[model samples]
Target: MRVQLFSDIASGAYAQKLLEIGEGLLGTDQDGMIPFTQQFCHAVESEDELIEKVFPNMQQNIVDENWLCERTILAPKNETITKIYKKILAEINTETSVYNSIDTVMSSDDTTNYPVEFLNSLELSGVPSHKLELKVGEPVLLMRNLDAPRLCNGTRLRVTELGRHIVKATILTGEAKGDNVIIPRIPIIPNNLPFNFKRLQFPLKVAFSMTINKSQGQTLKVAGIHLGTPCFSHGSNHSAKECRTPVRCSICKRTHHSLLHPKDANSSEENKTECVVNSSEAGKKQQQVLLATALVKTICRNGNEYSIRALLDQGSQASFVTESTVQYLGLKKTGFTSQIAGLGGN
Candidate 1:
């Protein structure tokens, strides 16, 4: 159980938020309380020193002066010993909410088009607009309207493993790296599936393509996916980028080998010429093959739509698909003959 909890602490964006909080609570300039936090977290000589330091910062944030005087709350410093007190105090922090409706805490769950009023007013003097990732429904205690540079581009959506949800969105071709969203784990699947199975269990990371409508608005610097199996993903057709696949050959249209392999080309002379290929030439071929496989091929028809002809492909598998074979089939007289122009009028 301890290992599971520790792993959970390390995974996802939660650790990042904690680090930011720790940094803010300590001070801005000198790496915040990272060194102390790390030491406290690792604890070679026990957590007495670290807990004293970490808890006091939080206690001071909420506890009034009288509370400290009454001994109801102990002043935390870099020297105490009780770790449980710090943990409880940390868990009891007030959830953040927006004051004016312009940027308020999410009342309902899923939100859309919600203007990022708070985001627009951030102190982003040198930051690029694209770098910002503000989620409306994200739970955050409005950190005084971007008074400082934010380490995380997006809002904090507190998903209770048994209460809140964790939404995982992949960085599509054009999206900024590490950008994501979190929604309520409240399942909205069709009634076919059991809804009341349990409460608060978050969904596992679901690999999916970005919506086409969303892709229409942004200019992607880099695309994450390339050519996923045609329709394997939900938004495959709408995805701006292709899915990743094993590099394959161009000329042979083979998905197994990428560099033409020389030996696998069915033709002998072609292989010999390429066998002694220089590194530079090999690199160029690899690029060419990759491009050819990725880019959609354009085959101009003879304007004869869906034209067909008798094809005597004698033998189970004797030859390959070639322009000559197609031409011969088009010109053959299978009892009913017609003079049809080829692709290039040949």
Candidate 2:
């Protein structure tokens, strides 16, 4: 049941409502695995420098192995995984298996037939119609739940036989471990696309590594997380138990609640669970904070416009923009540039 709940959360069926509470402990109770993975990543970044000094035994775990360096990575959405798979394949200059999705043409009993170009132009389903690369020994993930125990959804697999019609994969996870399964073309309805339109394709995706959301119920002994942005899910960071050998965390400089040195007396319980947003009250507070904050906008007097993302710091007296933003916007400076003093008076 817990595993199913975790899978549901990963599917994002409970995203909006849960996301609201995800800023609180309720989200953690819903799905703790992804949050734990994220926290583990953050702790890795935070303990990078002090890892050797604070936890001598864990120092080697930092660079011992990296899974993200793999050629493929799994993600929650089929589209996302497809995109990542394509990108990695391109990066490695590897040849991918090209599979053209079947397009069914039908004329309604009372409706006129559409043109060939129009039918051809119609967008396909969630899965890509282009080349899909699958290599032997590379990790793969099942896109659908065909079997509960043997080849369930989100199951990790390794490619063994890539046939023209069927792709044979060995299960690398769960009770079906070491068992080989043949994957067949499955029907899939693309999200937000025409309801009547469907795509039939192999129910397999590359999974050399995966996004935190797609990593439900899977225990990761080692992880490599590249944070392009802040985690938006609940329990977005690693738990204290997961930080026994964290590798690269951004908060290493902060002496306050460093996870690397569990023996430290100053470490607060709250610090260890920074990603675990506990309590409805805390969730409400987070929403209120977001509501109160303003996104800064800039417009040239000449009617030139640009969109940008900026946080409104109510505590700060001065408004600021990054040099890159200014350059990108081509905003004219009213006067000579001056170095603004920060909190440290630099």
Candidate 3:
């Protein structure tokens, strides 16, 4: 069997426009159709515009400026993405404003405890420390699967009450809607690590904005994406049933790879070539083709493990299995389906 190993294809506005029409046909066949959701993202800009400008536009208008700000959750792909969030927070936390951290307390379950140094070396599965910033009415995303049906990972919530010890929140969207629940620090073990590390922290994180990689397997009614560079991954910018209108940077009119676009492309090209004699930069480099295979173990819901042939693709954000493999393993379905598109158009 010839299987494509973690390949990627690019798409522009034209390809996406056709996809919207195709999904529209499918929606028309279904009587109860949900309206298409609009999402925005920039391919080469930090999330500062998203946090400072785009988010505020979506907030509900309040008469009192002194009142608590609208609730929001912020999500980053990694620690590196959090720099922008921290920067925005620093500016807001002036002499006239205040911010605080809700620290998590770690306690051992049994009377016999491990040494402080040994325990200190352990790192949690999610957030490292228990420290969190809380703002009343802000939205939050559950980071771990606590209750699969009611409060699973990716569940949305709104903060109602906060403290140094615990948080009181109300479920915003799910079967547990309107349900008030107290969030506490919980112990977790990191996966695929040599050491049996364990730590306690709240199984939650911000969600107002998240990386495109993390957004996979999710359906968004409204989304704002901040693109810092061209997405080199498959399906990074594709979505179903929604028309995308490129919002060019007000400062730079061009879209592709731009922090700022030149006023005239033709003019800039001439000037760029002129500077080539003075700037002795090396020529462009070639990309190497990478291929690797492995025999990997897959565990099913019933706990049956199978060793199967798999591709070792570091670039892929998710793993995929064939329909036949799923049937052979008798894996149970979660009943959730996502439509994935590529250059060949499906």
What global local distance difference test value does model 2 have?
0.48
Tens digits of per-residue lDDT for model 3, 246-332:
744344342321221223233544432111121223563322222355668878668988888887543232468888888978876
Badly placed stretches (over 4 Å) of model 2 are 1-84, 90-95, 105-131, 190-194, 229-346
* Pairwise lDDT winner, candidates 1 and 3: 3
lDDT of candidate 2 over 1-346, digit per residue (tens): 0121222333334332333332343434454433543322333353233222222332232122233222233234444545444544443323456555554433253123543344445544324342456765556777666766566666677777678888887777676677878888776655554433445667666664456555645544443443434455666464434344333433554212322212223457655322232353445321111212234556755677766777633223346778898787777778766544332132
Please list all clashing residue pairs in model 3, or write none if there are none.
40-225, 41-225, 42-227, 43-227, 71-138, 73-207, 73-208, 74-206, 74-207
Tens-digit per-residue lDDT, 66-136, candidate 1:
22211111222211212233343344444422221122223233233333553334322111221212222
lDDT of 1 at 248: 41
lDDT of each: 0.27, 0.48, 0.48
User: Where is model 2 poorest over a 10-residue stretch in terms of lDDT?
Assistant: 284-293
TM-score of each: 0.16, 0.42, 0.46
Candidates 1 and 2 compared: the better one by TM-score is 2
Give candidate 2's TM-score.
0.42
lDDT of 1: 0.27
